[model samples]
Structure formats: structure tokens, C-alpha cells
Target: MKVIRAAVDEMWSVMGQMTSAVFRHGLPMTDKIAARTALTNFVLHIHPVRVRRSWIRMSYTLCLGGLSFFLFIVLTVTGLYLMFYYVPSTQHAYQDMRDLQFVVTFGGLIRNMHRWAAHAMVITVWLHMARVFLTGAYKKPREFNWGIGTLLLLITLLLSFTGYLLPWDQLSIWAVTVGTNMAKYAPIAGPYTRYLMLGGTAVGDATLLRFYVMHVVGLPLVGFLLMVVHFWRVRKDGFSGGL
Candidate 1:
């Protein structure tokens, strides 16, 4: 009997430990408990534990930055859906676009959503930056954060531009060629820079793969890291509203 009781006690302790690890504070009902729960959560902790009601009002923030982030999420989900049908080779890319348009179920909608959401994100991020500047939120300690936000904006544009070439049509080809030609005016390393961008002297298979890789992997990784830092800084710097 003694041994059985000891085993039961040990079992209960083990279960309790597992439960606490999973649930953190077991759940919170009151304001104080809710605050503690937020404090312990990684996602929730990104937002402050408290906020002034006036500071968070919709009129003050307009939520442009949040909407921009929401658009990015939409783009990512839709982009992933489109990727299974896309091939980055010049020979197959146009055919792949047609397959996405007519062959795959819901592919047209997904592709359109990705394209539109990308456009919306560009506008939204621009407005978000404008709001920050108009509010004088970029002064002093926030200046570095502002620079990071600027980099994120540029990344957003580059991601959109790189994606534009993946359709591999005459229009896309001409557009990228014209866009890259501007690099040739940069002096000494200009031609080399264009070569690096095109992966050759002209936009062809190498350029397609380069843009696809940057669109799907490189740019997104860098943009995501900067976005993480931007959000962290926003939380650290505190909202400038109600000032």
C-alpha cells in the first residue's frame, strides 16, 4: 500500500509539471490574471500589457501598419498556394501561368489575391510610414527604428518587383529589362551590377531563377527579420499617440 501511494504521488507530480508547462498560468479570469497571461505569452507580449485608451484609438493610429501586416500575411498564404503550380524556368514559366489560370482549381483566385494583396501592402506600408512621420514619431530614439522601417519598405518593393518577372511573358521580360537598364547608368560597376542582377547580360533562365529565389527566399527572409525588429522596437519605443 505504501509503495502504491508513493507511485501515485509521483505520477501526480509529473502530470502537474506537464500541465504547467503547457498552460503557463493555468488560465486567467480577472484583469490582473489576464495581464500576467499576456506577460508570459510570446505572441501577446509583442503588444504591451497595458495601453492608454486614448493612445490606441482608431482615429489616432488608423491602423495602417497593422493592415499592412495583415496584407503581408495574405500575400504569403496566397503566394505559397501559387508556388506549387509555378516553375521558374523561362521555357515553362509562361505555360505554368496558364496552368495556374485555367488548370488548377482556385488558382486564379489565389493568384489574383496575391497580386492584389501585394499592391495593397505597398500602399499600406507607405501610408503607415507617412503617418509615423506626420506624427513626429521618428524623432531621436525612434530614428533608428524609422530607418529599419524604411528598409522594410524597400524590401517590400523589391519583393513585388522580383515577383513581377515570374510570369515570363513578353511584358514581364520587357519590364524587367527596362527596370534593370537603369542600373547601367551607375558608373564604374554599373554593367557588372546589371549582370549580377540579370544573372547574365540579358534576362533569361538565369534571371528567372534569380528573381524567383529572391522573391521566395532571400528577400522574404530579410524582410521578415527586419519586420520582427520593427515590431520589437515599436513595442520598446512605445506608441507616440496621445502626446
Candidate 2:
């Protein structure tokens, strides 16, 4: 036990020496001989010298972006769990969905949670945007963040649209069909876009598969990547004030 303690102390000493060398040029530690007492100590390195907890709490209340991010995390987790029991094929898809509701344990609850969370994420993001806009937080240095937020709003809408067809129900089928048909209104590329989306002229097995893949994999992944950038940029730009 004594030898082990000696080795641990030696390791801490080496770490202390390394940290001291790194910060030596910037500022010298004057108070303590022990590494633990040194400001250069690794364990103490991240401790803030000064902090205003009230300011932080107020900042969070003013900035709803963090709440939006939390909702997105909830959606992602519940969505992945729902995907485990859901199949993308048209023929058995509806039956499998029914099985999820009636046969599988907690399947209905999981699907409900995912569905509700997706909706809540959309609402929270919009609220965050509204909060930013109302407070004039989008002005000046935040214009770029505003632009990213706009794109995220569009992505959120796309995510909802893509996920609409997953249940393979009449409402999902017709809703997606109508939505995709609007794509046909786009000049020369419209018809091709519609064709690619439906995988043919009409919604069927191929359409179901495409939407499922997009909802469960493609759009969510894109949203997640953009969300990371969006949050990082928010921190970089600093928190905007509330009106």
C-alpha cells in the first residue's frame, strides 16, 4: 500500500511538472508547494476563478435555444427506439405497426413518445426563433445564427413531412402523396422530383421505403449535424438579451 501510494504521488508530480511548464511562461504559481494546491494542477485547471451563477441562470431563461436542443435530444432517442420495431416495407408495414400498438410491450407508448417529442421539438424551435426575433437578437452579430436557425426550421418541417408516411396508414399515404404532388409544380425538374420521391407515378411500396429511410435515417442525421453547428455558433456569438 505504501509503494502504491508512492507511485501515485510520483504520477501526480509528473503531471504537475507538465502543467507547470505549460503555464510557466504565462503566470507563476506562488502560494503552495504541493501540486494539489497549485493553480496549475490538472484537477483544478477547469475550475473557474470567478463565476456569476445568477447571470448564467438568467441567460438560460432568456435564451430558449437550449430548451429546443433538449427537445431534439428527446426526439432522437425515442425515434431510434421506435425504428427498432418499425419496418419500411409497404405490405407488412401496416400490420407491423398494428403489432407495435397491440402486441409489443410498451411499443405504443414508445411510438407515442417519439411522435409527441417530434411535435414538441418543432414547437420549441419555433418558440426559440420567436424569442430571438422578438428580442431583436437576430440583429448585427447574430444575423448568421438567424440564418442557420431559419434553415433548421425548414429541416424540422422536412423531418415532420418525411416521418408522416412511416405508419403506412391512409392518412400518411395520402398526405405524402399530396405533398409530393406539389413538387410536380416545379418547372421542368418537378416531374423528376416527384418520380424520385414516390419511386414511380404513385405512392406504393417504393414510396413507403423511401420516406421511411429519409425520416428514420437521412433527415434526422442532417438535422443533428446542423443542430450541433447551430448550438456551437450560439455560444460563439454570445447569448442575446431578452426584451
Candidate 3:
């Protein structure tokens, strides 16, 4: 009976540790336990063990960074759904869009969500950067992260620009034409840049294919990698909002 009781106690002890590992929140019985939990738990490690209340105040930070990341997630999901039916060729791109709108179930809704989420992400990332600047969070050791953030913002804009032409509408063609034309004013590299972007002289099948590849694959991968570094830096440097 004593052996069985000992075995049961050991089982319960293992179970308790497992529970603690999974749910590390709430007040611990002691500071040692809290510190250990924060050190050992994956989720807890992502956040600082302690922070000043003002650092996380909604009014000061406005939750813009989180909102922007959330919008990015939404765009990724909806964009994937749209991709199943989308072909990047100029021949089928517009017709695919029309079919998505009129035939595919919830396609229109998904497309609109993707579009609006892209727009909102741009706004939120801009506001987040502005808040960081205004709060003096871009100074000192935090500057590298700030640069990463600026790159993120640029990537967001490029993603939007590249996606603007995928629908193959008249408006998209005109907009891209005007946008690419502006690339020709960059001194030595202007015309070459335009040609590189268009894959030739103008926005045609090659342009559509190039933009589509960048929009759906290349840019997002780079942005995601940057974001991982950004978050890591944020953790290491601590919250600048408190500064």
C-alpha cells in the first residue's frame, strides 16, 4: 500500500509540473516559482517578466503594432484563399476575378477582406511607426529595430502596389502604367528599374507574372523574416513605449 501511495504521489507531481508548464499565468506561490516559470516557459519567455503599467497603456501605444500584425495575418489567410482561383496571366486574370466575384462561394467577401486588410495594415504600420517616433522609441539601441520596422513598412507598400495589378482591370493597368512611369525619373537607374519591374517596356504578361510572384511569394517571405527579427529585437531591447 505504501509503494502504491508513493507511485501515486510521483504521478501527481509530474502532472502538476506539466500543468504549470502549459499555463504559467496567475500569481505564483513564490517569486522563485514565478522566475522559474518565466525562464522555462516558451510563451512567458516572449514577454518580459515585469513591465511598468504605463508601457502597455492603450492610449500611449494605441495597440497599433498588434493591430498591424493582426491585419497582416488576415491578409495572408484571405490571400491564400484567393490564390486557389487566381491565375497570374493577363489572359485569365480578369476572368478569374470575375468568376471569384460572381461564382465562387464567399469569394467576393474574401477578396474584399483581403483588400481592406491590406489597406488597414498600411495605415496601422504607419501609425505604429509614427507612435514609435513620437515617443522617442527610435533612439539608442532600439534604432536597429526601428530600421527593420521601416523596411517592414516599405515591404507593406510594395506588397500593396504589386497586388494592385493582379486583378487585370483597366484601372489596374492604368495605375500600374502611371506608377511604373514614375520609376523612370531615378537618374541612372530609372529606365532600367522600370524595365526590370515590367519585364520589358510595359505592363504585359511578363509584368503580371513578375508582380504576382513578388506579391505572393518573394515580398511576404522577406517581410516575415524581418518581422521575426523585429519581434526578437523588441523583446531584447524591451518596450520603448515605456521610454
> Which number leads on lDDT?
3
Best-to-worst order by lDDT is 3, 1, 2
| TM value for model 1 | 0.88
Per-model CA lDDT versus the true structure: 0.91, 0.79, 0.92
Off by over 4 Å in 2: 1-63
Which of the two, 2 or 3, has more TM-score? 3
Candidate 1, which segments miss by more than 4 Å at Cα? Answer: 1-29
lDDT of 2 by residue, 10-77 (tens): 99999999987766533435333333344555645433333346534654455466667777777778
Q: Candidate 1 at residue 150, lDDT?
A: 95
Q: Candidate 2 versus the native: TM-score?
A: 0.75
| Candidate 1 structure quality by residue, lDDT tens digits, 78-165 | 9999899898997799999999989999988898899889999999999999998898889977998999999999999999999999
The TM-score, computed over Cα atoms with residue i paired to residue i, of candidate 3 is 0.84
Which candidate comes out best when scored by TM-score? 1
Residue-level lDDT for 85 in candidate 2: 79
For residue 89, give model 2's deviation from the true position in Å.
0.3
